[model samples]
Target: MKKYNRIKLWEGLHSSYWFVPLLITGAAIALAFFMLTLDSTGKSGLMEKSGLKIYTGGADSALTLLSTIASSMITVAGTVFSVTLVALTLASQQFGPRVLRNFMQDIRFKFVLGTFIATFIYCLLVLRSVHTDAEQPFVPKISITVAILLAIASILVLIYFIHHASTSIHAWHIIREISDELESNIDYVFSENPGNSHPEHKRQLVEEITTGFEQQAYPILATGSGYIRAIDYDRLMNIAKSKDLLLHLKHRPGKFIVRGSKLVRVFPFERGNGKLTKEINYAFILGRERTAFQDVEFSIKQLVEIAIRAISPAVNDPFTAIRCIDQLSVALCHLTQREFPSPYWYDDNDQLRLIADQVTFAALVDDAFHQIRQYGRQEVAVTIRLLETIATIAEYTRNKNNYVALLRHANMIRRGSENLFEKLDREDVEAQYQVVLQRLAKI
Candidate 1:
């Protein structure tokens, strides 16, 4: 069979089960034709010698009325042939090969048995005309009983195969989810927040040579671009080593990560691999770009985690919190404007829409807006006025100031769209921006 194996390659062709009825029909036709030819020129009866008797008083003869050998054979054959064409064609055209492949793998052998038994039963019906004056025979034909048995067995086997195949596919999906998640985390950290760590701040490396990273760790979310290196995550390991921060590394590859998700906890070890302690601080929190996620459910969960981690530093160390929040806000806003214009600087709604149940990125963005507003809450009028001015120019700057809502008011505009910047007086906005720039310069 291996040398020119039909069985090995048969699956590559259309499903064998799809031809089940056709095969039985073909067999019935062959038996009918052979019996008719033996009986001769549609006249003579080989039936006389066989000693069959007709018991129906003026009952219609099956042979003369139905043309038992010709019509039954043809009907059986047509049914088989048409069914095979319909099933196989539907599988290929409507469902496509992937689903069809799974289906046929389960039922091929039983289908063959079903065809064989059905043909045998058809042959028994032909036996009726082989003998003459055929009444209902007192004893059933041996061929009829045997064929029925095979049909039953074949159907049972088909059922078993179907059950087995479905169970296998369900298990496979779980592992795929895990591997996909890890790749997502890498994309978010390296690409989405690259160049700058957040939306509101320019990324500045904090290099120093102390035990400053003693208990430092951060989460990597899978919302950004997935792992760029298709070969593996060797790129990240190399980056860690380059920054001289590759101390006691921890983490198994191919694990899913959420946003702000903490990875292997570690402190800075002996820094030597080209990493300046003060210049290259750990930028653990990361997010991928918009398009990287294929599974929105998986990616959204990761983003929410990153958001939670983002807020942790605020309570633990407010100064560091201020820096982290500033950078994240800026980075998020930059990421948004890169694609379509969004009213909120960070609207993960379109991309992570599927995982909305798990991670409400909208809520996180709204929360960050609230957290940052507290900074301007102090009675310092200068800082408060500066915040409002900046909010007017950079809408992202307004998120914490309740200024974005003012810009986002759908009711405020006559056009029925809430893009305030589009309708705002440009000179007034520019004037506000210049004032903030002066304040920023002074700071």
Candidate 2:
């Protein structure tokens, strides 16, 4: 049996709008049962002596009212769902499919769906409590009134959902949301003083990992094919410490792997127990698609997708592309300041227990601008923004190698513009390119 991390389970539930509502509905039904019981027992002083008029209606009237509300709620729920699907379809078409996940994960959409379903369930549960006895009828007055309130609340949520869905699909909102998410993900993954910011530090870490130990290692093959979503570093480190073994991860999160491919290489080549292999496999959480939780690059790619869509000839929306570039610059600026985790994981005694690949600032810089340059080279506004983004990122970092990376990308943007832009447009791009060169020269 394959064990999944809790993060994966929560992510799956979070992406869907149904889970929370279903849980709430179940709780509502249970609460309805308890509250109806209180109303049934006339022995309670509050129920017997309340001045508020309890439902004085007969069972048939109560049934008709509850049934009508229940039926209407369900009908509205269906309509809301239909509208949600339409919104998602339009967003995917207009923005790009990458952002569809953001729409699916919107809390407003989930709350609206959950609210209606919960109201319907609450009504049905309360309706069942209206007993039709010829001599002594029973009515859960409080529960019925609560149901009415819920129905009203559902109406409010419906209105809110309409407004949210309309605004969420706009190009600016989508770009801003992706950018905000990218910024937060960068903060989560990188620390205040990323040790690998400097070239010498990065080279030292690599040298230590490569030359730290000499042991015969055996490869652990992946049982499935998918993107590496998350890795259980604590567990892998514990396994290495307990067994006195060294583990070298072949790839990091966001990398795709095929079945039967080497996932990790375990040292000392001893086949003593099958448990080690199982534990090693369990540490890797593979999924059909990449997620933003542990993969910062995946978030970056989301912004990239929007930029690509904005610049496409079908859209010709360079302003939206420029907005995306501006946000990417924000994300890159934050990333440059933070410290990336070392690829080498050391044990308590300072011995290297794991060698996992880590993301570098240079690689991130490339990921941020390479694709946009390829697609947006013809658009002078986009190309100018691209050069400006690189230049802004260059100003924030102290690392010399990062300066080199920025200059290289700046040169690429200049060359790409010269080829694609008209002579006049090319001049404007060169002007921006010179600004980037001046910044790099100061560094």
Candidate 3:
């Protein structure tokens, strides 16, 4: 499997509610058998020799204790499941459905669920071994003791889970979590500086290479319709390099495609074959919804969703919107200092093999704030914060294009505020707009 495919598979498993519980339950089963082995072989008496003296009761007492633990654990497990569902519902309603992915992927919630289930299963398995009416009475003392310890540990997990579920639903916590994720994704995606000293020089080179290929290249149409969750760049480039083909990608991750839509354009139409089409299709992973794996815009959209909802007429919570803006500013500032990868890909021979669609800084800025500005225009505080965010981003950037994008948004905010804000509020916004201009003016 490819690296990203493996990562995606793991991510799918990790984000699920059942995977951890399944693993923990499996471990619990294995542990039950192991403890039974020790007890049947008379090895459990070693703990008593070591002065541990834990759970040294008879078969009837062991049965009663294990039964109590098992029943209590199953009940608590049900309670945890109910609480988790409630939390998920609240998160979806308040933070948008996309944000529920964060709660689903939370390790604490999964661990608590797993611990309770595993404890229940462990107690049941141990309870099955206790028999008072048998010819040779037997009680797995060690297993019963471990069950007790697990019960105690489960109580602590329950307490921690209660705290986690409560705090995780708070607006500020959700906003900060997404902000942290956005910053991390920026670092992951845009880690390298431009290879060429001038970006325009590289753009010209790309245009030169693909000058007449558009007319002659064979177009590859998508077979299914969905959002492009991730593209296997290495696989795509390898297929192009091996077949001596030049592939031009028509869309990037996060783009929705319809059946029969153009997915890629292949140069030298004579070399295009059905097998090559299938292989190329195999390199793209489509899904019902967008993911943050390679699509940084998905995270940006989540924050924007929260901000717009907060500023809506029903919510009218500018403070939450401001928190979102603050977090977005932090991410944008970090982004301003990073370099985006070029869309052009070359082989070892320095011959261009792939022309991939790329994400631009301007597109990202628009994604991060355009909707917020549109929705929050009438709100003076949100408008001023929008301009202030631009100013903050301006301080970290040296790129001319970044300055232009920031200035454009600042001017738009200024224009919107002039029509909506009263005299005193307009002065506050105008002051922030001037600060943005001054910041962008610096070297």
Best by lDDT: 3
Kindly indicate the candidate among 2 and 3 with the higher lDDT: 3
Q: Can you write out model 1's per-residue Cα lDDT over 89-160, one digit (the tens) per residue? A: 654443233333334443443344445445545545544544444564222222223334444554564465
TM-score of 2: 0.90
Clashes of each: 34, 1, 0
lDDT of 2 at 26: 83
List, residue by residue over 1-443, the lDDT tens digit for candidate 3: 37767877877897888998999999999999998999899987788898886787888888888889889988999999999899989989887999988998888888898998999999888888888976988888888889999999999998999898899999999998888888887777776331223345556767776889889999898988998888888888889989999999999888999989889999989988788888898888887777887778889999999999999998899999999989888888887887777778878777778888888889999998899999999999899889888988887999999988988898888888878637998899999988988998894
Q: Put the candidates in TM-score order, highest first.
A: 3, 2, 1
Name the top TM-score candidate: 3
lDDT of 3 at 60: 84
Across 1-443, the per-residue lDDT of candidate 2 in tens digits comes to 13347778888898877787788788788878877877777533475486665565667888888999899999998998898899999899988787888987787787888888888988988887788898877767777767777878888888898898889888888888888887777776664222122344455755755663334577788878999888877788888899888788888889999998988888777752467767788888988878886678998888888888889999899998888889888988887777667777777666667887788888988888999999987888888889888888878987787898899999999989878637888888888899888888877
TM-score of each: 0.22, 0.90, 0.95
Give the TM-score comparing model 3 with the true structure, all chains together. 0.95
| RMSD, every candidate, angstroms | 21.6, 3.2, 1.9
